[model samples]
Target: MAETFERLPEAAETGGWLVRDEEAVAAQRGVVWELIKQVGQNLTQGVSLTSVTLPITISEPRSYLEMVADGWCYAPIYLKQAAVEADPVERMKNVITFAIAGLSNTCVVKKPFNPIVGETMEGLFADGTQIFCEQVSHHPPVTNWQVLGPGEMFHFYGSGELCASFRANSVKGHQEGIHCIDFALDGGTIIYGLPEVWVRGVMWGDRIIEYDGLMTFHDPKNKIIAEVKINPEVGGWFSWKKKLPTDYIGGDIFKYTSDPSKDRSSVSKISGSWMGCVLFDDKRYWSIKDDCPKFELIPADDPLPSDSRYREDVSYLKAGDMEPATEWKAKLEDLQRAEAKIRKNYCQEKGINYVPV
Candidate 1:
């Protein structure tokens, strides 16, 4: 069984408290809440910003001296500045209102354990215009200690009403393994407002991840545009490799060479691991040396092989001239039909719906 915790009021106005004698914890939560609110305020003004929330949950054994920090942190500005441009009244009302509601229940966990570290999972959903998000983190503690402070904040647009629910739970025992889940949802609509767009925000360490809603413009005079449904799932595993610095070389291939004016350079100087894959068009072309390979046309109506023969055929095609556009188009159609058939067969086999976009 999991131990349940009550949802704290918005930390922005009334300061929140969970564990007693933890003034620092409460202050941290309050600051985070205010930051979330600020982000919401900026969004309404057509500003796209990214933020991070760290260590949503924490637990551990008093003897181990092992600390586990698990929570949401992301590092990418999700929405474009152009997505929110509209009348100031409508934008402010919608953006600020949405941020307060959206940041309502984000979870942060920080605990100390041994040998095993903690993990987190996060996701977002959009029902046409409305957007929602959830984050979860868990840890096992050795000594009995009450959870002190945990807080979260979600942000969205103000054109819709804010009706979201938040929850968090924890448990411990001799058994091993930690589980956590978080969710957020926004619903309602505006009769005469700007077009709807779905937006989701996430935080992972110093990185911020966002799934900005898709837009389709329709009217030029009214500047009417509709945002499509967006479902984005963002999470990361705790690993030591993440701490290591990458050795990637910058700029195009020419920048690393001895001569800037030369069109052809020595290929051997390009020192990096090379992986090859086949490209599909009218015909198959296998990539070699990260450059365009030769092209050959395959019979469009023929069945694609299930064995290594597919790679062999691709290699053979790349040894020839580029396939004609007419042949390529026909082949593409055949490939699409084959894909549809495969999907249908798999859905029937698994007793699932065949929903394709």
Candidate 2:
């Protein structure tokens, strides 16, 4: 049986523990506001804010690569179940449920450290799931990652290029990447796309993370697709009419026909809040309130030189050494910039265009 725990109060949900300290919140907000104000003076609304330097006051004590790897905490359970499910649509149900569960693991109020190029992370989850990630590029920042479920039950791999644009009170994130999973069952490959994320209340209102838009899960071998709509908060005033769950997601699994105009038959319905419970065809599949498992990075005996665990900024932050953490963060960013310049110059001298491997 899975254990259950009460959710944190609204303050934790909005600001996380980092912002609950009034003085710290005030100091952090002041810094964030200054950055926003500077951007307002010089940049357009949708311009990339990658160059905006943020203090360590708002950082989570982990690299973005590690954060992404930890998102698959529930994969061991779901992928194992998916491998044994006879029906293709049911297998997809398990897969999509795993996908939604990943979202909950990643929806944090604080930002994680952007991975430095050539940085790598390898860890094993408590459930024997092994994961690896590498920061393959710096410009446009991309990371390549792969996960292997326990006993080779499943394989999940992808490259992620997360981009964000800052607004007066929010940041909109575009998750550009295709993710794929291969399970033990025959023809059990699922390819999927991610939804956009909106981190609201950065400057004024209560800070919250919301996933918007649709994620499509495609099983080409079975000619089936599942379209999930996540937290539709559009249409300003009219949004109130829906009155849905805070993290509501609704989707339908259907078999695709060769004729584009032909109507397709629905195989099953998926309804639930990604942050909490998920139901497939009215049957509960997963629930965070009941079984919100977490991934722990097992200590490696022989760590790589480029491992995120060796990063001084992240280590200091985890140890609650704020001043040193901030200093190391700045030093690392400067080092990354210098290394990028060297790489650019070398590519120019070689008459070759720089490309992420």
Candidate 3:
């Protein structure tokens, strides 16, 4: 269950954490203010992240670590797959259900803080499931994560690489990564491809997110293949829609044969919104009615240096204090930059290598 917080600010106060000039109050026009002015100003040679300054808005804020880890909140579903059924078809269905469950994070619209390299997070679940993650690289902006989930029944791990660039009037994020599910049931492993993301309306309209890409699940041992398509956000200029709408993802799973020449019509079909119930073989395959199960946050008694809870900016945001949140968030980034320099110099003096992960 998600912890409840204070209500969002009044409309006149802000517009979803956007900024025009770091004003404690919302920009004059609020959401109507063109993001292009802010995003475009930062455009130096191409598209730099800090061309235009913003009048920070505090809406919903969460650290990048928590955002990435949230994807695995439904990992407990693997517990049900511990013992495979005698029938191969039933076993394959289980894989499809679990695969989709892991994508429950797609429903979230807010963006997370980009993690700094070498930052790591560790936690212990009440049920003895161990979880760990780290920002392994920075040049390519990569993150690696793992979960020893459901009483150690399976190992879930993956790495995500974010490569972003500026286009004519939009920012595109290409997520190059793969995730896997390793089961103790039959030593079967299924793999999933990451999705691509984009933030539109940044040029002259209200900023909103769009998701597009493919999610593939392959079980090498059983020769089962599941392909789920993630559709792009619907709408364009002159549209009232300002959020990524839920789109249906349906695909076919072939049994035994990965033959390119064979017809894919006879394979099992699964389709639905990534945020809601997926229909498979004309039946509901899987759905996450809520965000996810509870996650272990920074304990009041003990917290890691890189823990999200320890970040003053985020703490202020959670309490619905936008002014302090915005001020501290900027300071937090500056501090990270300074600290990175210190670490680099130390390594140079000691002739030691920096740990990427």
Candidate 4:
């Protein structure tokens, strides 16, 4: 079996997210089938998949903390527009575009490394927007992140918790947490949550990734809101249909009152593919095909010791050293358990409830 398979490129192309050869695909399918057999016996409704340790062959080089940073890679493009726009409705449109831009980065299907407690990552977006993230908890893993746009145009901060379950041949993940963006001007605050993620054909068939759910953006102070529904690429088990476009999203932005359900009069219609261009009322607003700026992480002069960039397992994988990477990954898990025991003892002695530091 080939330990090294082609990694996903930053942008999507005609072929697909992964450019794996036939040999690699066959090798992965064999290992994945064995894993499914082992997990099948314990499977019930909503059984947690976190306890299953995936081999290095199917894992990506980056950590989960760094993956979260990918969601804000295009902050410079849309968030900047929202910060300066005077009209509240137009500003809300920009915010929605920014939210959708992150979807493009999720095209990669490989699983990232699970972050250890105290793991941290810091970097800058293309527009010099600074971002800092930390793994605040281990059990039912949670991460807290903050992004400060250049010139203080906007502040983005949130805590995200993801729980995934093995269901049939697919893995479904539910993202729990609220994401907020506060504009420096009178744009007030915009709050929203992420859509559910599904990894289909885990054990057989062609592997396809999809994000499906309704996302609502609210700016109560400005009396405006937006609802975007992500369309999945493939139909459910009983429905047979041609594959849909990847990252297709559509919705409406409109004015609302105390109860948004009462008013559906859309001020601007949103339609487009998240991987390509987003349209507002039949006009193009954001496009990946155009010369859109890409994300580049600015090197930190004095990064913390716990930074994800310094992880042994990730570094080994990046260097194409599979054996060491897999070994270090196991060692890290054991280290995390020992550290958790120490923390629990200290907290018990102090007579205080344990809280993420």
- Computed on alpha carbons, the lDDT of every model, listed in order, comes to 0.23, 0.74, 0.57, 0.75
**Model 4 lDDT per residue over 153-209, tens place:** 899999988789877777788769999999998748999999988766666666666
Off by over 4 Å in 1: 1-14, 17-86, 107-123, 126-357
Residue 62 local lDDT, model 3: 68
* TM-score of each model, in listed order: 0.17, 0.86, 0.68, 0.86
TM-score for candidate 4, residues paired by index: 0.86
Residue-by-residue lDDT tens digits, candidate 2, 155-209: 8899988889876567788769999998775857999988987776666655566
For model 1, residues 91-163, the per-residue Cα lDDT tens digits are 2222222221122122222222121111111122221221221111111122111111112222222111211
Alpha-carbon shift of residue 252 in model 3 (angstroms): 1.3
RMSD of 2: 4.5
Instruction: Name the TM-score of candidate 3.
Output: 0.68
lDDT of 3 by residue, 182-295 (tens): 777668777767666555444455444455666677777777776766652333211234443334455667765565235333367665555455566666646544344544
Task: Give the distance in Å from residue 238's predicted Cα in candidate 3 to where it truly belongs.
Answer: 29
Per-residue error at 123 for model 4, in Å? 0.5
